[model samples]
Target: MSTPQEEQARRNAAVLQAIGAQQPAQPEWPAQPQPPQEGDLWVPPLGPAAIDPTATAEEGAGKLSLAFWVLPDAVFGMILALALQVIALFGFMAAQGLKTQEDIQSLQFDPTFTLIAAPTLGIGFATMAVMRIRLLRKLPWSWFGLHLRTIGPALGWGTVAGFAFLAINFASGLIFERLGSTPDQAEQIIGPFRSASSLQLGLLGLFIVVVGPFLEELFFRGYVLRAIRQRLGATWGIVLSGALFAAPHALSITTGFIGLLAPIFIGGLILGYVYQRTGNLWSCVLAHSINNLVGFLGLLAALSLP
Candidate 1:
C-alpha cells in the first residue's frame, strides 16, 4: 500500500513522462495512463500544426516591394529617353564638322535639354501619380524621404559625397595631365555657369544643381534602381542601373565616351549603394546635388581667378 505522499509523487511522474519532461532511461517510471473516457480525450503529440492562413498571408505581404513601384515607370521613361538620345547623337554626328570647343559648344540647344529633362520628370510623376491613387497620397514625397527626420544626416552625407567626387575628378585631371593626355571634359562641362550673369547663374544653378538632382534621384534611385533590383537581382541591377546613368552623360562629347562613362558609372554605384543602405532617396539626392554644386562652384571659382 503506497502512502499518500508516494501516490502524489507517482502521479506527478506520470504527467512528466506523458509530456516528455523526463529522460527515457531514468528510473522514475510510471505507467502511461489513458484519460478516463467521459468527455474530451487527451490527444497524443504530433509535430507542430501549420500556421493559420491569416498569419501566412500577412507574412507574405509584409516585405517592401520595389518591383511594384519601379518597372512600369522605368520602361515608359526608357523608351522615351532612348528616342531622344538617338536624335541627339545624330545631331552630334552632323555637327562634327564644327571647329574648336566653342563651336562645338554652340550647337547645344535648349530643345535637347528639354527632351532630356522631360522624360525623367514624366516617369517620376507617373510613379507618384500611381502611388497616390492606390496606396498613400504622400507616397511619392515619402519615397523622396522628405522628412524633417533625416535632414541632418542627408546634408552631412551630401556634403561628404560631393567633396569626394570633386576630389576624384581633380585627381583624374592631374593624372591625365601627367600622362600628357587631355584632362577629362567634365572639367569644361560646367564652364557656362562660370561666365553667366548672376541671375542667369542662379536660374541655371537652381535648375541644374537642385531641380535636376531631385528629378534624377526620384527616377533613378527611387524608380529605376528599385525596378532593376526586383527584376534582375542586386548585382546585375547595380551594373545596369549604373550603365543607364552613364548613357545620359554621353550627350556631352567633351567627356568623350570613356571619361563620361566612368564618373557616371561610379556615381550610379554610389547612389545605388546609398539607397540600399539608407532605404531612402534623400541621401542619393543629397550626394548627387552636392556633387553637381561642387562641380559648378569649382568651375566658377576657376573662371574668376586671374
Candidate 2:
C-alpha cells in the first residue's frame, strides 16, 4: 500500500486536474496581456517612455513664457485701442453730423467722446489681456495679483502714496515753471475738459476715478509686470516694466517739457513696487485712482474759481 503522503499528493493532483477540466481551454495564440489594475506598478517600454529634451520649458513648467505674455498683450491692446477710436469717431460723426477731417479733428476734444472713448479702450484692452492669460496659460485670476484679502490695506497705502506722488509732482511742476519752461502738453490736453458740461465732467470723473485706474493696473502692474518679473529678476523687471508703462504717456510729453516723463515714470515705479510688495492689483489700482481723483478734484476747484 502507498504511503499516506504519496496518496495525499496523488489526490491533490487529481483534484487540481478536475478543477482545470471545468475551466476554458487556453487560446492558441499567446494570451494577451492583462491591463494594469489598481495597485499595479506598470513599467512602460524603455524607448517609448523616454522624455523629450526638445519639449518647451514653459509647457513643462505649466506657465506662459514672456514672449507669449507680451505679444498678445501688445497686438490685442493696439487693435482694441484702434477699434474704440473708430467707434468713438463714428459715434461723434453721427451725433454732430461731422463730415470733413477738420470737423473730426475739432470735435476730437468733445468731452463726451473723449471720456467714453478713453475708458472703453482701456477696459477692452484689459479684458483681452486677462482673457489671453486665462485661456493660453490656464492660470487663475489671482495670478494677475488680484486678491481681496489685502484690498483694504492696499487702498489705504495707495491713498497715502497717491498724495505723496501728487505733492512731488506739484513741487516738480513749480520748479520747472520757475525755470522758464512752458506748461506741459498734458495741461493743454486737459484744458478742454475743464470747460466740458457738468454731465461730461461727471462721466470723465467716473472714468478717471474708477475705470481708468482699474484697467491700467490690470494691464501694467498685473500682467506686464508679473511676466517681466518672472523672466528677469525683480529689480530689472520693475524698472523695465515701469519704463514700458511710461512709454505711451511719453508721447504726450511736450517738446520743451520732457520733465513730465519723470513723474509718469516715477508713478509707474511706485505702482509696480506696490504691486510687487502686496501682490495685489487693486492696491495699485486704488492708489492710481486716488491720484487721479485728487487731480480731478483739483481741476474742478480750479475751474470753479472766479
Candidate 3:
C-alpha cells in the first residue's frame, strides 16, 4: 500500500505538472506515513502560491509583496512626463508670447495649449509606461488590466459609468458654488473652446475623448493602481491611487486648490474601484473621457447662456 507521505508527494508532483513545472520523477518522500489530520491541506513548498479563493492572509500577503518596483516605475515615468510637459509648455509660451503675469494666467485659456497638451504628455507617459512594462513588469497587457479580449465590454460599461459619474460631478460643482465657489470659474475652462473653429473643436474632441483618457487610464489605473494594489491590498490600493491621481492640482496650498482637488479625487476613487472590480483599464478610460466630455459641454453651454 502507498504510504501517506508518498501519496502526498505524488499529488504535489501532479500539481507541479499541471502548472507546467517539472518535478523529480520519483520525489523523495518521508519514510513515516504522517497522514494529515482532517481539514489539513497538502501544500507544495516548491511551487508558487496557490490560487485558492480561500487562501490564507499570509499567502495573500506574500502575493501582494510581488511587483515591489511598480510604484517606483510609476514615479519615474511621471517625472519624465512632467519634464517633457514643462519643456513643451515653455516652448508654447515663448511662441505665443509670455511676457507678463497676465500672459501666464491666460495660458490655459489658449487654444494652442489644448491642441498640444495631449500629444506631448501622452507620448511621454505612454512611452515610459510601455518601457517600464517591458523592462520591469515582464508581463502581458493583462497585468495592466488592459487586454484586447475585454475591449467590447470595457468600452460599453465604461461609457455608461462615465455618464453616471458626470451627473454626480455636476452636482458636486453646484454644491461648491453654494459654498462660495463662483460659476465664473467656468470661463477658465471654456474660454479656449467657446470661440474655436469647427476643425479646432473636432481636434479638441478627438484628444479629450480619446487620447487623453486612454493615456491617463493606462498610467493611473493600469500602472499606478496596479502597483499599489500589489503592494497594499485592494482598498488601500484604490484609495491611495485615487489620491495620487488628484495630487497634481492639490499641490497649491490654497483653499480653492482644494476645490479643484475634491472632484477629481472622488472621480479617481470611483475609477480605481472600477478597475479593481473589472480588471480592464479601457473601462476606466472610457468613463473618464465621458466625464470630461460632459463637463466641457456643460461649461460651453453655460457660456452660451446670458
Candidate 4:
C-alpha cells in the first residue's frame, strides 16, 4: 500500500482527470404533445366530458347535466300529447251526439289520425323552444344535429336508410309470421283508411307522410338520441333510444303487436345511426318520410281493392 500522502495525491489526480473529460449531450424533448404510438389504448375521460369553456361555439350538454331532464321530458311530452288527443276525440264524439256505444265504436280514425298532428305539432314546438332557451342552459339546437347545412347527406343517406329498413322489416316480419305471429298491428294501421273519405284520406296521408315523420325524428332522433348517447356512449345510446321509441307503440290502437316491435326497433336504430352519422335532424326526418310514403302508398292500394 502507498503512504497516506501518495493516496491523497492519486485521488486528486483522478478527480482532475475526470473534470477535464467531455460529457455526453442530453436529449432535447419535442415541445408539442406527440401523437399516440402503436398499441396504445384510449382511456376514456374520468367522468362526463366538460364542455370546453374556450370553445367558440356551443359544444353540447354533458350527460350528467341532462340526466335530470331527459326521462321527465319524454314522459311529459307523450302524456300531454296523448291527453290532448283523447280530449279532442271525446269532444268530437260529444259534438256528433253519438250517445250509443255502437256509434262511437264505429267511428273512423282517419279524422282522428289527422287531428293528432295538431297536438303533436304543439308539443314539438314547445320542446324545441324550451330546449333552445338560454335560461335553461340553452342547449343549442345544432348540437342536437338539427341543422340544414348537411341537407344532402340527410336526404340521400336518409332515404337509402329508409328503403333498407323497409326491406329488412319485411324480411323480419316474414320470420315472425313463420313463428306463429300475426301482423295485427300492421293491419290496424291501415284499418282506418280502408273506408276513409277522400278529403280525410288526403289529410291523413299528409300527416303520416310528412308531419308525423318530422315530429318523430325531431323527438326520437333528435333530443332523445343525444341524451342517451351522452351517458351510455354511442353504441348503447343507439340501442336504448331505439328501444324507448318502439316501447310507446305497445298500445292496442298502434303497432302493439309484439312481433312488430322488432321492425319498429330496427327502424329506430336506423334513424339513430343516420342522425349520428349525418348530424342532421332533417336527414332522419326525410328517411322517416320515405318509410312513411311507402306505407301510405300501400294503404292506398288496400283501400282501392274491391
RMSD of each: 11.3, 13.2, 12.6, 7.7
> Across residues 1-306, which tens digit of lDDT does each residue of candidate 3 receive?
999999998999889889999655787788875676898775443323232122232222223443465566556766776787788788887897788888877776677675776466556556666666645446566666778766787777787778777876777778886887533445554677666777877787778678878887787787777656654667777888788777753432345555567777888888987887677887898799888787667655775776
Candidate 4: the clashing residue pairs are none
Query: lDDT tens string, model 1, 68-158?
Result: 5454555566565566656655565465655566764564433333334334433444455345323542233454444556667666766
Candidate 4 at residue 180, lDDT? 68
Instruction: List model 4 lDDT by residue over 97-141, tens digit each.
Output: 777878766664544544553545446434643563333655666
- Where does candidate 1 have its weakest 10-residue lDDT segment? 47-56
Question: Model 3 misses residue 100 by how many Å?
Answer: 9.5
Q: Looking at candidate 1, what is the lDDT of residue 97?
A: 58
Off by more than 4 A, model 3: 1-75, 89-109, 150-153, 182-185, 250-255, 303-306
Give the clashing pairs for model 3: none
Q: Positional deviation of 185 in candidate 4, in angstroms? A: 2.5
Candidate No. with top lDDT: 2
Each model's lDDT comes to: 0.58, 0.70, 0.69, 0.68
Candidate 2 residues lying further than 4 Å off, grouped into runs, are 1-64, 180-186, 253-257
Assess candidate 3 and give its TM-score to the true structure.
Answer: 0.67
Error of 2 at 227 (Å): 0.5
Listed in order, each prediction's TM-score against the native is: 0.57, 0.72, 0.67, 0.75
RMSD of 3: 12.6
| TM-score of candidate 4 relative to the true fold | 0.75
Worst 10 residues of 4 by lDDT: 50-59
